[model samples]
Target: MAADVDWDPYYGDRRTVLALVGLNLDAAAITARLTGCLLTDDELADGFAAWPGWADPFAGFFPLTDDINPA
Candidate 1:
């Protein structure tokens, strides 16, 4: 079972959220646009976790990256 979270309150600001979406784009073309921008590792990867879940609300599966190796 999953917890019901009031996520809207946490992301109330639209512009900031949009900017973050822009930052999360993985295209090579925008590499220069975000050049030198300071973002923590989590900031970079949070989109991956939040995206597919939101895009497919019923799906619980997510794609993991190589950086997170299992013990």
Candidate 2:
């Protein structure tokens, strides 16, 4: 059997959340990676607005499905 604990406390630390998602980068590197996408202000707004409906909001700006494994 599995146990259930309140997740509210863990949500307060972004690093913990990102680590849970498999992204080990710190906040600054994450910010740089995201900002380096070069999305325009309007595009950024559109991405946010389309988020709930779109399965992947960043599909327009990034490749979410491409295999990145090196040979």
Candidate 3:
């Protein structure tokens, strides 16, 4: 995702805010590195509460099992 942003300058503007769900993502670190900032925990929950689609931003790309995979 960071590479995509670096390759395409407009990518940042296209996806201004990123909402990570069902994953232990470091939003602050990501925010500092990429131009597209991630949404906070409260904001993510609010989005899920407001919209059903917001609950799964990855469109079911996440793993089915509860296995830890280091990135």
Candidate 4:
């Protein structure tokens, strides 16, 4: 599921969102750094909780040219 995400000032793009559903601390940490966030375990959990209904936890960035199908 990939729909328009809230615009992030740091990333400066609505499509610059990524989620790691199940990863170890090391991998998640690396990914967070790559994604420009130094998220704590709680923060990551919050992200999952706050995720939009139209988005999937495993979905990567979706370009504007693509269609978003949450189903």
Candidate 5:
């Protein structure tokens, strides 16, 4: 049996939360759990809106490279 860890205490620390998400250990689960805990619904909506191509899952399939030559 795994020990349950209460994540509420860590919610107030943005860096710790972000670092946890960045670890990608269980990103989807972590994101879902932290969704409304750190930010309000409106703030979350605004963040989603501000992220480019966030609405489209296929957006990252063909990543943009910075090596393009403009002639």
Candidate 6:
């Protein structure tokens, strides 16, 4: 599963990020977060209906690094 994730942008490195996410999670917690408040199978169906393979609903948490301020 980690192989499928490319989290370097936020994590700086996939291994480091995977470790961070892993520290806060176990199988049960991962299941709960995905099922309880964050995203459920049904919700994912609807969320992904707009686009096929976009991952991470919270990706909008960070603004594009390339975005510039016009002053």
Clash tally, candidates in order:
0, 0, 0, 0, 0, 0
Candidate 4 lands at a TM-score of 0.20
**Local lDDT at 55 for model 5:** 51
Q: In candidate 4, residue 48 scores what lDDT? A: 58
User: Model 2, range 2-71, lDDT digits (tens) per residue?
Assistant: 1234334644432322331455546776667655655576766696666466454345644566687735
Q: Provide the lowest-lDDT 10-residue window in model 2.
A: 11-20
lDDT of 3 by residue, 18-69 (tens): 5667566877755575543356667666865565535454545456776686
My TM-score estimates for the predictions, one after another, are 0.17, 0.23, 0.24, 0.20, 0.24, 0.20
Local error of candidate 6 at residue 8 (angstroms): 24
Regarding TM-score, does 1 or 4 come out ahead? 4
Model 6 Cα displacement at 45 (Å)? 1.3
**What is the clash tally of candidate 2?**
0
Q: Looking at candidate 1, what is the lDDT of residue 22?
A: 38
In candidate 6, which residue ranges exceed 4 Å CA deviation? 1-17, 21-38, 49-71
- In candidate 3, which residue ranges exceed 4 Å CA deviation? 1-15, 36-71
Per residue, candidate 5 scores C-alpha lDDT tens digits across 1-71 of 12235334645433342564333267676567655345556656687556564455344544487765545
The stretch of ten residues in a row with the least summed lDDT in candidate 6 is: 16-25
Error of 5 at 7 (Å): 28
Model 4 ranges off by over 4 Å: 1-14, 32-71
**Pairs with steric clashes in candidate 1:** none
Positional deviation of residue 18's Cα in model 5 after best superposition, in angstroms:
1.6
What TM value does model 3 have? 0.24
